[model samples]
Target: MSATTTTAETAEPAPVHAESLARLLVAGERPPRPNALRTSLTFGWRAMLKIKHVPEQLFDVTAFPIMMVLMYTYLFGGALAGSPTQYLQYLLPGILVMSVVMITMYTGVSVNTDIEKGVFDRFRSLPIWRPSTMVGYLLGDALRYTIASIVMLAVGLLMGFRPDGGFMGVAAGVLLLLVFSFAFSWVWTMFGLLLRTEKSVMGVSMMVLFPLTFLSDIFVRPETMPGWLQAFVNNNPVTHVAAAVRGLMQGSWPSMEIAWSLGWAALLIAVFGPVTMRLYNRK
Candidate 1:
């Protein structure tokens, strides 16, 4: 027994060679590279997974919208519209747009966060569609925009906010908002790639967003503003977006405004999409 055990213990293992080791590690034919849609969707799923692991990220889409609806509805309600409930009719749609639009900055923040963590370096080295990564960020953020809109709509309904356009109209409005948001996100994503830090991204996004959102028809009518302010407010893309949404909700079907909104959304994508990709490629 001692002789047999010693022989087993001293037995030499098979010699390892590079070619044989590679064969053992090969995953068969290296499946064809994923297409852009597949890769983008995969990255989008990865974003959702991050949200799943850290559910606290959902607070902005939920709690923040609620607070905006409540605060704006009550604080300016009586003063602006003679009653809180009365104000909601005019305010809800605008607030909804404002809430969702404001949170878009988080896209840049997320991108910068990933870059800081070295996640993007690996992404850059992958043999996949170049724009898929940024597109994925926009697609994942679409869910957030939807959640924020739904939350705002629910709160508005509970507060006696009524829309004449009914469910179909509201749905169409939300669809349009999502479309706009999808295009608008490219702007921030570009900033995310350009800026050195997430904080810089956030700061720049805020400087732009605050003026972009507040200087429009979100809180009041453009006609009521001073001449110079009205010029900016009337031409502001947010004004067109808010007008389109409000009209849709109220069953007005503001075709001109909708066209403007869609046009602006397209323009944003056209201008920023290429810039974002270039920055991404260089980064």
Candidate 2:
């Protein structure tokens, strides 16, 4: 009878001890919640690593701008400004803005790719803030945008496009372009969540971007268009961004144009950020 009791007591203690050990192990394995900045940086680093593995991912940013600058300056320079040098001065700023804005669409395309590949599920499983993933996507693309800007400007300089705004003005123009690009990224991010495939997101993004960009003063003066088309181009947000960038590069900052561009950026973020967050959470 005593042997039976001793066996039971020993077996009972083993189960309790096993439970205690399990609880401790679980506590150790669970990571502590990270702060927002740290979480964003973590995901941003993840994005950089992804880019490192696929350096060819930057071909659009690097090659597209160079090609556009050479083609447009050579093709349209004589007709537009009587010389390639003069036209480059006019075309580079607008092209810079257009190129950066166009690249922003990739942010959404990448996010959609992650979703389709079940990466978002893994991200959701992590303890970080949900928005951090999206923000990290944006942060990661920021480097790409900056690289595009530098490449475009370098090509422009080689092509004899000198900015009257000099260094400070050029810096201001680049800053404004970055701000607009960041805001534009959110629009794509929202689309990424709503769309099913990366290709669809990119298609819709280009469809929307091409029209706005082509119709705007990025390539030609609004006054040159039909009255109705001129009105639309004048009101287009891309027009304002181009105007602001041009003004800065030309050393004549247009206050009204800058204000309008900033207003549009604020409106984009206010409207799209929440919508994206809600959709992302639903997924």
Candidate 3:
């Protein structure tokens, strides 16, 4: 009996206290939750990291803007304004608006891609602010929009497109564009959460963007169009935004256009932002 007890004792492992085991596993108290801005910025950094890893993502911002400036400046210069240099002045700002606006659709594509990869599901399980993921996508794309705008401006300057608005006016114009773009992105975020596939997000974005962009006064004056088309173009929000940006760059304030653009941008955000969050929560 003594030998059997000794053998059993030798076979048993040492007992571990709950306190000691917990101390070994978790060393410190939990840290406070991060603020919304910090969380949003962190997610934004993640988006930027993606661009850093995939440098090819910059092609639309760089090469595409350069191509648009060259193609349109030369193509419409002779026929529309009698000279490339003369046409560039009228075309550059409008092109800047159109290019940046068109690229904003990619924000939806990125969101849909993340959703497809199940990245957003992991994000949702975290303790961070709910809308940070969506906001981060826009913040990242905002940087891209700024880059595309600068590229367009540089190409325009090389081709004799001068901004009479000088530095401040040009800066204000770009700022307005960024603000509008940020608000516009919420619409796509809603679509991103709603769509099942990246391709579907892209298809819908194209259909909406192409019509809004082409039907506006980006390429030509509204009066030059048929009366019915002119009415639509005149009332189009893109027209107000393009006009506001064009006016700001040319040294004209166009306060009414700016107001209209801001109003439209605010409307877009107010309507789409919550819808996106709702879809995100359900998703």
Best by lDDT: 1
Task: Estimate, for each residue in 1-283, the C-alpha lDDT of model 1 and write its tens digit.
Answer: 9999999999999999999999988957778999999999998998888889999999999999999999999999999999999989999999888988989999999999999899999999999999999989888989999999999999899999999999999999999999998988888999998999999999999999998899999988887889999999999988899999999999999999999999999999999999999899888
Q: What is the C-alpha lDDT of each candidate?
A: 0.93, 0.91, 0.91
Candidate 1 stretches with Cα past 4 Å from truth are 1-27
Candidate 1: 10-residue stretch with minimal lDDT: 22-31
Query: Candidate 3 residues 149-241, lDDT tens each?
Result: 999898888878889999988999999999999999998888888998988999999999988888998888887889999888999888899
Q: Judging by TM-score against the true structure, name the best candidate.
A: 3
Candidate 1 lDDT (Cα, 0 to 1): 0.93
Lowest lDDT block of 10, candidate 2: 10-19
For every model shown, the clashing-pair count is: 0, 0, 0
RMSD of 3: 3.5
Worst ten-residue run, lDDT, model 3? 216-225
